[model samples]
Target: MTNHFPLTAKRSLELLGLIAIFGVLYIAKDIIMPVLMAFFISIMLLPIYRFLRKKKVPESLSIILPIILVALFIALIVWFFSNQIGILVKDFPQIKSNVSQHINNLSDWISRITHYNDKEQKAFIQGKSDDLMNMGTKLAGGAALTLSGVFVFIGLLPIYIYLMLFYKDILLRFIFMWFKTDHHPKVKDAIYETESIIKSYLIGLLIQITYMTILLGGILMIIGIKHALLIGVIFAILNLIPYVGALIGNIIGVLLTLTSSQELWPVITVLGVIALVQFLDNNILMPRIVGSKVKINALFAILGVFIGGSVAGVSGMFLALPIIAVLKIIFDRTEMFKQWGVLLGDERPAKSPMGFASFRKKKPVAVKSGTEKEE
Candidate 1:
C-alpha cells in the first residue's frame, strides 16, 4: 500500500518553503534585483532582438543596439527632468514665499478651530523643522552609500541583459531539463504566456505613462498651473505603484500646486484634474492596454506590493504584479498548486460557499415552505 503525508504536513512544508524563498530574496536582494530586472527587460526586448536576428543582423550587434536605445531613452528622460528641475529651482524664492503664506493661512485656520495661537503653532513648526533638519543630515551621510549602490545596479544591468539574451537557449534548455519529457509542452506554454504577459504589461505601462504625463501636464499648463509638467512627470512615475501610487500622486499634485502658487483654486483644480485623469486611466486605458490575461485580485496585489517592498524596496514593489503573474501562470499549470493560482486571480464565482450569491450575479434567495430552515 502506498502512503501519503497528511494535509497538515503538506501545508507546513509549503509555508516553510515560502519563508525560505523570501528569506533568501531579502538577504541577497542586491545581487538578485539587477539580474531579475534585466531578465524582465530582456523579455520585453525579445521581439526586437528576434526581429534583428531575422533580418540577418549580427547577434552581438542586435543585443547591443537594444541596450543602447534603452540607454539613450533613459538619458533623454533624465535630461528633460534636469532641465525642468533647474527651472523650478530658479523659482525657489517665490515658492518659499508661497509656502510661508500657506503656513500662515493654515496657522490661522488651526487657531480658529483649536485653542492654539499663532505663536504656539510657529513654535511647533520650528520644533518639527529641527527634527526634519536632523533627519536630513542623517540621510545626507548615507547618500553616498546609496548613490554607489545605484551606480553598481546600473553598471551591471546591461551586461546581465546582454548575457541573458545571448544565453537564452541555454536557459530554456535548463528549464526544460528540470521537468520530465512529458511536461515539456506545459512548460513551453507557461514560458510563452509569461513572455506575452510581461511584454504587454510593460509596454502598456510605457504607453500609460506617456499619455498620463501629457493629459495631466497639458491640462494643468492650460490652466496656468506652475510646474505643471513636473507634477505630471512625478505623478506619472509614482502611479506605477498600483493602488497606493495614485493616492500618493494626488497628494504630491496638491502639494506641488500649493508650493508653487498662493491660490487655493489651483490646489483644488490640481486635485480635480488628477482625480479625473486617474479615473479615465484606471477605467478605460489600463484594462484595454494591459488586458485581463493576468488578473490579480486587489487583496493579494496589495499584499504582494507590501511584501515585495519589504523584501526589495521600490524595485520589488514595482515588480510585484509581473512576478505574481508569472507565479500564477506556473501555479495554474501545475496540479498541486492550481488552487493557489485561483486564489491569486480576480475571477468571481457565481455564489459564495455559504450560499450567498456573488454581487456580480445576484439571485433571489427563495426559501422552501417547510423543510428549509431560515437560519
Candidate 2:
C-alpha cells in the first residue's frame, strides 16, 4: 500500500505570502534605508530627550535642543571646512612640491631595495603617479557629490528628526498594535530592551571614538607628524568599522608617514603608537563600553559589519551592532523566537535540574563504601 501526505492550499498560500512580503521589501529598499537611518539617529538621541523630560523640560523644548545642537554642530563643521579651503588653496603649489619630493624619495628607496634600475623605477613611479592623481580627482569629485547630497538631505532631516522625536510614542504604539492585546506586555518589554541596547551602543561608540581621536591625535602630534589632525580624524572615523578598521587606519597612516619622510624610525614609532592605542582600545575601553551592550560573538559581529557595509556602506557598519542587539532583544521576548534568542545571545540560560530518578538513571552511579560516584 502507498501512502500520500498531500500539501494543503493553506500551506501553499502561506508560502506565497512570505514570498510576497519579501518582494515588497525588495521593492521598498530605497524608502526603507532613509527611514532606518532616521530611526537609528532618533534612537541614539533618545537618552538626551528623556533626560530633559526628567528635568521637567517640555517635550517640544527637549526635542528642539537636540535638533538645534545637531544643526549647530554641522554648521561648525561646514564653517571650519570653508575657512580651511582658503588656506589650502593658497598653499596648494608648495603642498604639491612637498608631496612630489616625498614621492620621489620613496620611489628611490624602493628602487634601491628591489634592485630596479633608474628607468624601471621611473616607469613604475610614473604609472603610480598617474594613478594617484586620478585617485585624488575621483576623491574630490566624490566629496563634492557627498556634500551636495548632505545639503539636500539637511532640509528634510529637521522635519524627520522632529516627527520621530515628537510622535515616538504613537509610532511605538502602532508597532505594538500588531500583536494580540495579551502580548502587549511582552511587546513593550522587547521594545524597551531594544531601545536600551541601541542607546547604550551609541553612547559607547561616541565615547570610544572621542577617546581614540584624542589618543591618536596626541600621539601623532608628539611624533611631530604633519597632517596629524587629519590622519587622527580619519583613523577615528574608520575605527567605527569594527575589527578591520584599526588595521586599515594603521596601514593608511604608515603609508602617508612613509610618503612624508624617508626616516624609517618615524614610521616605526607611528605604528608602535597605533598598536598601543589599539591594544588599550580592544582590552580596556571596548570591553567597558561597547562589549557589554553588544553581546554578540566576534564572528557574528564581524559578519554583521560586513553585511551592513555591503548594504548601507559606512553608516550600515556603524549601525550593525545595534541592529543585531535589537534582533536579540525581540527574540528574547517572543516565545516562538526563544530558540533564536538562545542562538543570538552570549549568555546561555541555565538548564533546570532533572528529577532525581531520571538523573540517577542517566548517570548510573557506582556505589563504593557507602559513597555514590558517577562512572
Q: In order, what lDDT does every prediction score?
A: 0.89, 0.73
Candidate 2, after superposition: displacement of residue 104 in Å? 4.2
| Model 1 worst lDDT run, 10 consecutive residues | 359-368
* Sequence-dependent TM-score of model 1: 0.93
Could you give candidate 2's per-residue lDDT for residues 297-336 as a string of tens digits? 6777788788777766666677677777787777667665
The top-ranked prediction according to lDDT is 1
- Cα lDDT of model 1 by residue, 1-375, tens digit: 124557667778888998999999999999999999999999999999999999999999999999998889888888999998898799899999999999999998998999998888899999999999999999999999999998999899999999999999999999999999999999999999999999999989999999999999999999999999999999998899878788888898898889898889999999999989999998898889997887898999999989999999889989999999999999889877777777787764534446654432322233244234444
Q: Write out the backbone clash pairs for model 2.
A: none
TM-scores for all predictions: 0.93, 0.77
Q: What is the model-wide C-alpha lDDT for candidate 2?
A: 0.73
Candidate 2 ranges beyond 4 A from true positions = 1-30, 54-56, 77-115, 131-145, 346-375
The true-versus-predicted C-alpha distance at residue 148 of model 2, in Å, is 2.9
How displaced is residue 105 in candidate 2, in Å?
Answer: 4.6
Top model by TM-score, which number? 1
